[model samples]
Target: MIRSINVSSATLRHGIIHSPFRLVTKPSNGLRFCRVRPLSRPSRPSIILARLYSDEKSPKENIKPTELAKKVLQEAAKRENIYTIPNMLTFGRLLASPVIGYLVVTHQTSWALAVFGLSCVTDLLDGYIARKYNMQTVVGSVIDPMADKTLMMTLATCLAVSGDIPLYIATLILGRDFLLFLSALYYRYISLPPPKTFTRYWDFSLPSAEVRPTTISKYNTFLQMIYLGSSLVFPVLSQSITIETAQSIGMALKGLEYVVATTTILSGLSYVFSKDAVKILSKPNGKP
Candidate 1:
C-alpha cells in the first residue's frame, strides 16, 4: 500500500541547514524519503507593538507611537483650561488651611472659627460653580481633593496637639493621607509623558492622570470636615449656648467621631481595592 509518514524530528548530521520539521511524503521499498525546508517568519520588535490605530491608514502610514500620545495629550490639554473662577476659589480655600491651623494653635477660637467658616463657604462655592459652569479641569480634579485633605490634616494636627481630638484618631487620619500622598507622587512619576523633567513633574497644568474619588471617599471627606469643623466650633458655642444644648451637641459629636474613624479606615481601604480610583489618561493601546 502506498502511504506517507510524517517525521517531525529527524536529526540529519550531514546537513548544516536546520529546518523546523521534515515531512515524509512517500514510502518505497521499506524506506521513507522526506523534504526539509526552513520556515521563515519576519521578526518584529516588541517595542514596535505600541501603535496608535485610528483610521485604517493612520498609524501604519505616517505617525509614530510617541508622537500620537503627545497629540492626544495636547487635545486633552486644550479641552481643560486651568484658569477658571471655581479653580481660583479652590486655590483660595487651600491657602486658608494654614491660617486656620495657626489660629487654632494660638488659642484664637473665634478667629479660627470665622476663617474656617469662610474656607468652607469657598469650598462649597467652588464645586458648585465648577459643575454649573462646566469649568472642570484636570488640575481642579487634583487640587480640590488636595485642598480638602490639607484642611483636614491641618485641623487634625492642631486639634490633636491642643488636646481637642483624640491623638489616635488624628494619627489614623494623618497616616492615611500620607500614604495616599506618596501613592499620588508615584503614579504621577510613572504616568508622566516622555521627557519627564523636574519642571514638568511639578507643573500641575500638564494633564497626565486623573483621580476619580470613590463614593466612600467622598463620604469620608464630608465626615472629616464635620468632625474637624465641630471640633473647632463646638467649644465656642458651648460657652454661649444653654448647658442642656451643649451637653446634647457634645454627645452627638462624640458619636460622630467614632463614625468618622470607621469611615476613615474604610475610605483608605477603598482606594487600595477600587479598580478605577485613579485613571491614567492615554490611548487605548501603548499607554503614555
Candidate 2:
C-alpha cells in the first residue's frame, strides 16, 4: 500500500533514489516498498517524455535537412531576385497580356484600353525601377524581353483576328521573333565548344551567351506598342466618329503597321549580320 505513495526528495538525498513507481527490497528494512525517487540523471522514460514535450513546442529541432533547405529557400525567395518591385511589375504585365488578348478578341475595347494602358505604364515603371534601384537580375534580363514579346504578339494576334490589322503583319513579326528565338537557343547551347562549321569560317572570342535586345529591336518594340495601342484606341472611337476621321486614323494605323513590319524585318536581319552575333557563333581561329 505504501508503494502507491510519491517519493520524497529527502528520501532521494538519503541515497534511496531509484526508478520511480518500482518495487524495491530495502536491505536495511528487509521489506518491499516502492522506491519513488528522482534519478540524479534523467531516466530513459523521462528523457523520452521530455523530448516529446519539447518537440511539440519547437518542432524545428525535428525537421529533416531536406525540409530545412526547402523552407530556407522559400523564405529567401521572398526577399531577393524575382520578388523585387521591377520584376513583380514585369510578372504582372505577363499576366495582363492574356487579359488584353481576351478583351481584344471579345471586342471589349474599353476594358482592353484600360488594361493595355496600365500594362504600358507598368512596362515603363519596371524599367525605371530596375535602373533606379539597381535591381536587375539575369532572369529579369531574359524574362523582360519574353514578357514584351508575348504581350506584343498576343495583341497583334488579337488585332489581326479583329480585322484591325493585316494578318500578314502579325505573321511577319511572329516569324522573325520565332527565328530569333531559335538562333538565340542555338547560340546559347550549340555554338560553344566551337562546332566544325562555325570554326571553319570565322575567328572570334566567345563570352557568356546572353541575347540582348539590339537598339533596332528596342525601336521596333516601341513602334509595335504604339501601333497596337493606337489600333485599340481608334476603334473604340469608330462608333462615335465620322467616316473621314476614322479613315484618317485608319490610314495612320496602316502607316504604323508598315513601319512596324519594316523594323521587325530589319532588326531580325541586324542580329543575323551583327559582328557580335558572328563572333558568338564563330571560333577564335577561323576567318570569314
Worst 10 residues of 1 by lDDT: 43-52
lDDT of each: 0.78, 0.69
- For 135-207, candidate 2 gives per-residue lDDT tens digits of 9764466567778888998998899899988889989878887887677556645443434455421221233
Off by over 4 Å in 2: 1-80, 188-208, 276-288
Distance (Å) between predicted and true CA of 148, model 1?
0.2
Candidate 2 CA-lDDT value: 0.69
Against the true structure, whose TM-score is highest?
A: 1
TM-score of 2: 0.62
Clashing pairs in 2: 202-286, 203-286
Ten residues in a row with the worst lDDT in model 2? 200-209
